[model samples]
Target chain A: MTTNSISIGIVTYRTSLEYLKRCLRSISFQSALDSVGSVVIRDNDNGFDREIIEQAIAASGLDKSLVKVVEGDNIGFGAAQNELMKLSFEKGESAHLCLNPDAALHPNSIENVLEFASSKKFLGIFEMEQFPVPHPKIVDPYTFETPWCSGCSLLIPSGVYEATKGFDESFWLYCEDVDLSWRVKAEGMHCYLVKNAQVAHFVHSRSNDSKEDQLRALPLISAAKHLADKWGSPRFSKDMAKEYERRSGISIDSDSLNNVPRPSPSSLLKAQPDFSHMLVFSPSTWIEE
Target chain B: MRPNITVVTRTQPGRESFLETALFSLSSQLLVPEEVLVVAHVVSSGPFVELENLIGAYKTQFNSIQLLTHSFEGDGRTVSLNMGLEKATGKYLAFLDDDDVFYEHHFSSLVQALEKNDNAWAFSNVVRAGYGPDGNGYSLRERSQPFKRSGYSFLDHLYENFIPIHSFILDRDKCPSEARFNENLVRHEDYEFLLRLASKFPPYYLDETTAEYRIRLDGSNSVLDGSSGMTSEEFMLKREIWVKSNYILDQVRKEIVGWWAPELREVTEKLGRVADYLSTTDLTKRMEEQKKAQAMVDEIWSSTSWRITAPIRIAGSIAKRSPIPKKPKVHSLKDGHEVVNEIKSSFAWKITAPLRRVKDAKLKKQP
Candidate 1:
């Protein structure tokens, strides 16, 4: 066990067991992870491709004692993270890592993140260099700046997670990490990019045959939610709305397409609106998955 | 499960090379389409002789290439897609533009996703790939990740339609047998069809990069400079349709939020606290006061400020005052790229630069 105690939380949707096995093996092999007593797999109950993942775990022959699986109905991403956060509080641990099922941690990624959390004066947000995918820069969500860590592999310090209130359940998918990082920054805490840490992320397909079109709409809805949350929806402005939809991978109805109103007077006065040129509907209009 | 696949292609004469590439990509690397049907308009231009030549090459490679060339009774592309659908035989249908290429993993990925899930309406991210003036190939665009929601419904359709026309794959069993692309809507026809599809099935995403969406200078889906301007007549019609649809959706969404708002007060209060918790400059403080001035608009959204403020939101009418725009805060790294200033620190500069200067100074002293 390392000097600080950290628990890892992995959220699994409809992912393959082979990947999960690879994921567990990678976490188990973390050179500095002895400090981690338990790794919780919060399985979003679509009956996770369980048989294969279990077989893979057995094949890897890692200590089964350190692994625990939690099954539940389809809770949103933020809710799942909150569940892990609640678990951490129950165990009296200080921090929990929200790892994507498709992502694998490097040997010392947890240690590096913890090391930063242990002594850093302010809220520290560090993202790893996503392996196989060459995105070296970390982005700042508040500014839409590049290099913000992809949620695929993020180490959440317990303090920052609690302060930020975990992921926003309103954001069912897409940009939850960006929203979290932004919310963390909103609380006056700083997010960082640890150049040394590396996480292997296997980008998975979000859609299968059963619900193809609905899967396509997820990003569109999330984008609208993001824009509505960040840049109040405007009355239809086709250009800005199209740009928003294209860039965010979100879609909107043709009338409401650019029909969301411009920034409310309150937002204009409180802080500069991030997307003044774009239009959005009320944040309430976003569909929860 | 067998490869339940359908191919939707609208062909014209001169696209011989595009046809060859599409056919080779579809037949060689991906799942063999249970039925490959091509809908071509009888028109003037490239040699039907050459079109036949391309068809022959594809047929040699795959057994199911059926060429159904007809002089369309209508003049729109959407009509052509509707025509193609009438002839499609497979249970799973994927739209392929005449000018696109399918990656090796496209069919396999779609097939796997369909097998894994109970509902099989899936779409994958497409790479905007372009051939340079020099004949070299390069990726022009990239998608960061696949979307989260996966179920087809009308509300999903009403939300947005960013799915590229050629990027979608449909299940034939749940397929709207009479569904037709909106022939009158030239610009957003795909958006309309997707909306109809979403109403019926839960959509899914194949996060894999499965196809290359070619960006051609002519005869393609690229939006040109003047092309962005909407005709006044077309604009008004679109607006009328949108307002009607959004009203219904808005009503439903508002009711859902209303049911939770009383219990969600804590969440709202927390959001308010989070808004107040945002870092403030002297200017930011004044902005906060101004936000409270307008009671009707409970929130403001824009890209300028790094934060989103939750306002004392009211229903129905919008506030008269529009928010001012601000530039996002940015900081530059030593490597010349800039980032937001929140993460900037003098310590980062202090940690990175001194070693180089120290080495240089020591060399001079030794000399």
Candidate 2:
């Protein structure tokens, strides 16, 4: 039998049980997945609905033997990806796909990625449109020619990941993709946006309440540190500093600021809620038909 | 008011005399640092003991001199400064390397400039020195410092950094509380920190010459001869920032939007222009005009008074002393000078030389 070519690693952090099920169902029901490699779900959340998630996995009706679910140490996104890269390297997998939990690839997305990969070697980011509300040309992940592959639907060749030493751990949340793409570019490898491959990223839904708040706040803080690291921190103007604070609300509170690191990976995984709230804003099945 | 300046020094091999002279120059100056903290990185046994002795001798004249030593944390300049910042108890921070000296008016002038303007974090024009066996050479010249353009907005400092960090006095309290010297960065760590700081504070220009930034070819860590390779930490540091700059630029765009919405439109227009330029392989007439317009923008940046004006002032000295052709010769034209006497006598001699010489000879023979 021919070995599987691509292994997909999805980090499901605080993803709703319904969304996870639907996402898994979409992946498992893909007609092109027979030659697909293993699907490894590294859960960064404190806990998840095992019965519901497992049942959804079973209902997708793909080969159950091809699945691997690993519990992570709650070590943020970059660290988790690094772990995936290590595991894939050991297994001799040819390529790795990093997918967000809320995103679902179209039926031909994987096939197209593979076909395009055969012609040109690259780390691919799929052309993404928001789910339920598609802008067809909304520029969120990149404003210009996509500089780096987005983590939402990134496809990485095994060689590129190893040579660049994976993503940096210092970047806890935001800019990890930016960091990775630059590293890939530095190695003389190109980062491509596979316009042919389509994936729907269900970004910023009301169901992901707590996670969204954390995501919004953390990205701003990381962004300021990123600026500080790139430009000289000592010369930041009052306007510049105020602008960073205005966007993120992370202030220079001497009372709150500590030289200490955040406590060891708090897995504040609350019970996954019913994502029926999304249906309120989302179109009905009849409407879709 | 006295500006509390902190001088950070790390002892290297065979540089004790230079360090002592640097310290003595500070001590002799009427306006010295409020407290000079010498944070020495004691690597080997060579000249560290002498540094200790020098610090011990000046314990009384100085304002609470503290000599702290760390057993070399793998040659990271950013890490060293971060460590110094943690221990520093100063209102304003000024960095001076061990090999450099400050003129007598350095501290007073910098402090005066800072006092005059409250909105400004201080920076000064530097005099680059070339010291050798004959003391400060002809290369000892005063010039305006180059400030970073990344901090500027339409009229304000947007995010441009033009001054070298070592050449400025930064307000400690007003500085971004979360800012750090990317201990990971070996090369552009200072640049990185300054960019962050510039994002938060408006830097003031001090046009006066304050300190001598020494460039001795004989120093232990001379830019030309320093052979220390990148540490594993430094390599990891660059890897960290290379990944971070783009991520930060994304944030930078967002932050820019928050303060000045107009700048975002301008930046987007610039990006559009770049994108349009990228599409055309050969420059069309329209594209050529756009290129010329871009060149004018560049010329405006280079010709700005506060920006590259220092080089304009130095061009005269550079031209005269320059080994290149086409420099006009300059000579002293004083009335009592030898050249003047030679010029005056040459015309008189040509007018009456032979007759006067023959008459004098005839008179002498008769006598």
- The candidate maximizing TM-score is 1
Each model's total of backbone clashes: 86, 41
Instruction: Note the Cα lDDT for every prediction shown.
Output: 0.56, 0.54
Give the TM-score (vs. native) of candidate 1: 0.38
What is candidate 1's CA lDDT for residue B153?
34
Q: How many backbone clashes does candidate 2 have?
A: 41
Judge candidate 1 at residue B154 and give its lDDT.
38
Chain A TM-score, structure 1: 0.73
How would you encode candidate 1's per-residue C-alpha lDDT over B1-367 as one tens digit per residue?
4436778777777666566656645653334576677767766533578888667645544447777676655444667688788877778888887777666557778777887887647777765543212123221222322222333333334544547777778877776688777665555667667765665576777666677666532213332112224586754665565565455444433454445534454565455334544533356564544444322122212221213222322111136355543332221111111122221212222233334345534763582
Q: For candidate 2 chain B, which ten residues in a row score worst on lDDT?
A: B327-336
The residue-by-residue lDDT of candidate 2 on B1-367, one tens digit each, is: 4437766654453566566656655554435576776766666654566777777766644676776666655665556677677777777777666766665455666777777777446766555443222122211212213332223343233333345555677677777666677665555556556655665676676655556566532333353123234475764665566566545543553564475645765775566446545655565754565555545434433433313334543574577785432212222111122232232223222233335446644763582
> Which residue runs does candidate 1 get wrong by more than 4 Å?
A46-48, A119-122, A136-148, A204-221, A224-227, A230-289, B1-367
Model 2 C-alpha RMSD to native? 33.2
